[model samples]
Target: MSTVLELSDVTVTRSGTTILDQVSWKVDSSERWVILGPNGAGKTTMLQVAAALMHPSLGTADVLGQRIGSVDLFELRPRIGFASTAMARRVPASESVIDVVLTAAYSVTGRWNEQYEELDVRRASRVLAEWKLSHLEQRRFGELSDGEQKRVQIARAVMTDPELLLLDEPAASLDLGAREELLQLLGGYASSPYAPGIIMVTHHVEEIPPGFTHALLLDQGKVAAAGPIGEVITSEVLSGTFGLPLTVDETDGRFTARAADR
Candidate 1:
């Protein structure tokens, strides 16, 4: 399988603080990986590196077969699909849902004078349909619920058919029903043979979708464990990663975690 991302001894330091330290990870085109970590674990920092939005302070990052520092970012960034609450916050609230997805064709956040062909519009519409957001195409983006907005962000991210897909807490701040709904859609997309390599960062094991194949656990800016989901998501691994006794179980391809003593 082709390697989608490779980070070797990558570290991110800023303002005299280190966010990620000596993180060496590889993601192949056929794998769907989920990153699990607590607050300040550098999960988002790692995602930013994968997205080519930030450069590592040390080591090298190769995304889509191109070295980050040597490649032109504007050309490289469009090849990676990224969804996050930070990205959603950049969207112009007054923009229409279709516009939100369409702007992604040029990696922009709002509608401008940039022209799009009929093909682009059709693609955006198709993506919205796939995400079950076709009915809201003409709706104002700001008017959507948290779940709807999250889906819109994902739809926008995939609009360009990126080679690597990265999601940061795609299911955050939603009710149980909405979270499950989004997870189902995400599961279907991740399972597709045509889906690109995916890396999602989430705090809860419950947020991981059914189709994910790998797990990377982080603790205090270091890799705790990285391997097949089943092997790395065990109670033993999680309890240590989180600094507490924790239990992890899977049923029907879904995972649940809680304190082991509970």
Candidate 2:
């Protein structure tokens, strides 16, 4: 499979605090990768580089075959989809559901004077339907439940049929029912052959969707293990990655983890 993202010795320093340290990773077009780490592991920072929103302080980042810092990011960014709480917070509370997804074509949150054509409207409708939000087309964005808002954010991300999809804590704060519902839909999307290369950042193993093919564990902003999901998510790897003794279990394509018996 072709590589959608390639990072080599990338480092990000913010006010003398280094977030990522000499990190190297690759994401292929056919892979669904889950980035696992405790808070401050630089998961979100890494995703920013991948999304063309942040430039590394050291080393090189190549996204979508174009090396960052050498290409026009405005053109490069549209090819990649990104959904996160930060992006969600930027959406206007009064924006309609359909407009929230439609405005993504122009990479804007709240619609201004930009004009859209019939084809764009049709595409937005199709994306909303795909994400099961067609019925909520006219609803205000802020009026949706947390789960529904998350779905709308994802729908907006995929509206342009991006090649690389980045999700940052898509299931972060939801009740059990909402989390399960979102996971069910996310699992189906990840399993689709038409879906883009997916990279999700989540702290809980339980939040991982079923169809994810690979895992990347990070500790202190460095890669602890990276490989196929089964191989990298072993008890030993996870224990080390989280700096605690833990046991990992899998059943029916889902996973769970807990502290090791004392």
Candidate 3:
């Protein structure tokens, strides 16, 4: 499989503090990887580098065959799809859901003066329907529930048929029902052969979609374990990543974790 994302000894430092330390990993074109970690484990920082949104402070990072810092990020960004809370916060609250997805073609947060073609509008509508957001097409971004907003963000991210997709905590802050709905939708996407290679960061194992193929567990700015999902997502690894003794359970391709018995 062709490598879609590659990181070797990648590190990020800010204000004399290191967030990611010598994190080396690679993602291939056919894989969907879920990243698991605690709050300060540098999952988001690694994602920023993968999305070409931030350059690593040291070491080489590559996306879609282009090395970070040596490539034109403007040209590289469009080929990468990203959906995150940080990205969602930039969307205009008054923007209609359809327009929110439409603007992705231009790589903007809000609809603007750029003239959109009929085909663009059709594609946006098609994507909204795919993500089950068609019913909310005319709703303002802020008016929708958290689940609805998440689906819209994902729709917008894939609007450009990007080669790599990055999702950061797509199910965060949602009620149980809302989270399951979004996870079901994500599961369907993950199973699709045509979907782009994906990397999703989440705090909980239960949020991992059914079709995801790989897992990366991060602990304090470094990898705890990384490999096939069934191999790397064991109770021991999860416990190591989160700094707690965890009991991991899996049934029907979904996982759950809790404090282990003493």
102-207 per-residue lDDT for model 1 (tens digits): 9998889999899999999999999999999999999999999999999999999999999999999999889999999999999999999999999999989999
Q: Summarize candidate 3's per-residue lDDT along 198-247 as a digit string, tens digits.
A: 99999889999999999998888998899999998888887777778999
What C-alpha lDDT does candidate 3 achieve relative to the native structure? Answer: 0.93
Top model number, lDDT: 1
**lDDT of candidate 1 at residue 168, scale 0 to 100:** 96
- Model 1 scores worst on lDDT over the 10 consecutive residues at 253-262
Question: Which sections of candidate 2 miss by over 4 Å?
Answer: none
| lDDT scores of the candidates, listed in order | 0.95, 0.94, 0.93
State every prediction's TM-score relative to the real structure.
Answer: 0.99, 0.98, 0.98
Write the residue-wise lDDT of candidate 2 on 1-262 in tens digits. 7999999999999999999999999999999999999899999998899999999999999999999999999899989999999999999999999999999999999999999999999999998998889999999999999999999999999999999999999999989999998899899999999888999999999999999999998888888889999998889999988889999999988899999999
At residue 227, candidate 1 shows an lDDT of 98
Relative to the true structure, candidate 3 has a C-alpha RMSD (angstroms) of 0.8
> How does residue 53 of candidate 2 score in lDDT?
95
What TM-score would you give candidate 2 relative to the actual structure? 0.98
In candidate 3, list every pair of residues with a backbone clash.
none
